[model samples]
Target: MRRRNRSTDRWRLADDAGSAAIEFIFAGLILLVPVVYLVVALGQIQGQALGVEAGARHIARTVAAASGTADADARADAVLDTVVEEYGLDRSRVELSIACAETAASCPAAGATLTVTVRTAVSLPLVPPVLGLDRLAVVPVEASAVQKVSRFWRDG
Candidate 1:
């Protein structure tokens, strides 16, 4: 005679109902991977922005130190390279654009300002490919750094 097996409490036991919860748990983890990747990408952008700004400040400081007659463009480029490297960016992907104001209204009354813009194309290796975001190819990341000339560099 088989005893009634109450040990298998059908109501409280795991059943088809729990299957959906299990699927949800797995799917949630899959979805969270992309979200976390995007957050990391944003952080990288922020870091690059700070690096560009620091480069600009360095350029401005260095240029202001030399005679106003010097060719600051080269020095500025070097400073930008160092800054990009410091920020852990690929030198090839990193692009820098600089502007030098020559007119009194633009550059006078204060030391020269160095505006350094750095941009790179960043791609999410694991997440984007799975989400069909690969069609976009690459996302452009941009940052700008501004540095003012020191008081000493100003023309009295």
Candidate 2:
């Protein structure tokens, strides 16, 4: 009877020996998944923000340097497209707005202040497209840049 009791005690201890490892794994997973998702979501938002900022800054410069309205529009479009592609931004989601401080009936007029704004909404990773949840889960990012048109600009 004593031997049997000892055997039961050993069995109970053995049963608990590997439980720490199991608990560790379970706890690690519970904490790791959310953290990893947060990192990925933040990365997406940051990348989009950088892309928008670059687009705005480059487009402002391009427009400010242009010779005329047509040239400015063309250059701005080109810069925006390049930045969108380079930054993996959704072209359909991007919005660009340009404003000038001078009201001489000419945007980006010589010595005028050019302000360019870029906007977009970033969607979280792994969001299911069901019930419009994917659309609802978005973070809006916007960036703006200002540049002064060259005073010696020519109207071509």
Candidate 3:
């Protein structure tokens, strides 16, 4: 066989045409996919957080506006149901708690503070349930709101 020209061999080795574009595309994908997934997860969590906050506020207001304790409890439950539906949250994963600040013996007295807490779990998109890691794939969001009973309000 004839000997290859050293200059042509060197030129072939130095040829880098189209390599930069390919490298850039690979690097971009490596950096972009995780960033996009993170943004989507955060957005979903934020929406659920906002929904929980709004639901707490609605529950507190509804409870405070009720004419009686029984009415308040019923109305609060109804509002919670509506919020669960509106937010598209799994009812089994959502929890609501109502308490009277500084008093646990009875219903809130006039001018007493009523606190409503809403909690829910938001599952991350594209995450599959892993053995012993199911809870890690979900984010928990909670919100609380307080409303004071009107001074003229009478307990039922």
Could you say which candidate leads in lDDT?
2
Better of 1 and 3 by TM-score: 3
Clashing pairs in 2: none
Per-residue lDDT tens digits for candidate 1, residues 1-156, read 878767686655656666888899999999998898778878876776676567656765666554443445567677877877788766777776655454555342246665556677655445456566774666677766566655454343
Per-residue lDDT of model 2, residues 1-156, tens digit only: 334678888888998898899999999999999999999999999999999999999999988888888888899999998999999999999999999877867677889899999999999999999999999999999999999998877766
Q: Which candidate do you rate higher for TM-score, 1 or 2?
A: 2
Q: How high is each candidate's TM-score?
A: 0.59, 0.88, 0.84
lDDT of 3 by residue, 29-126 (tens): 99999999999999989888988999999989988888878888899889888888887777899998888886746666677898989999998898
Clashes in predicted model 2: 0
Ordered by lDDT, highest first, the candidates read 2, 3, 1
Using TM-score as the measure, the top candidate is 2
Worst 10 residues of 1 by lDDT: 100-109
Q: CA lDDT of each candidate? A: 0.63, 0.91, 0.86
Model 3 stretches astray by more than 4 angstroms: 1-14
| Candidate 1 residue spans exceeding 4 A from truth | 1-21, 68-71, 102-114, 127-136, 145-156
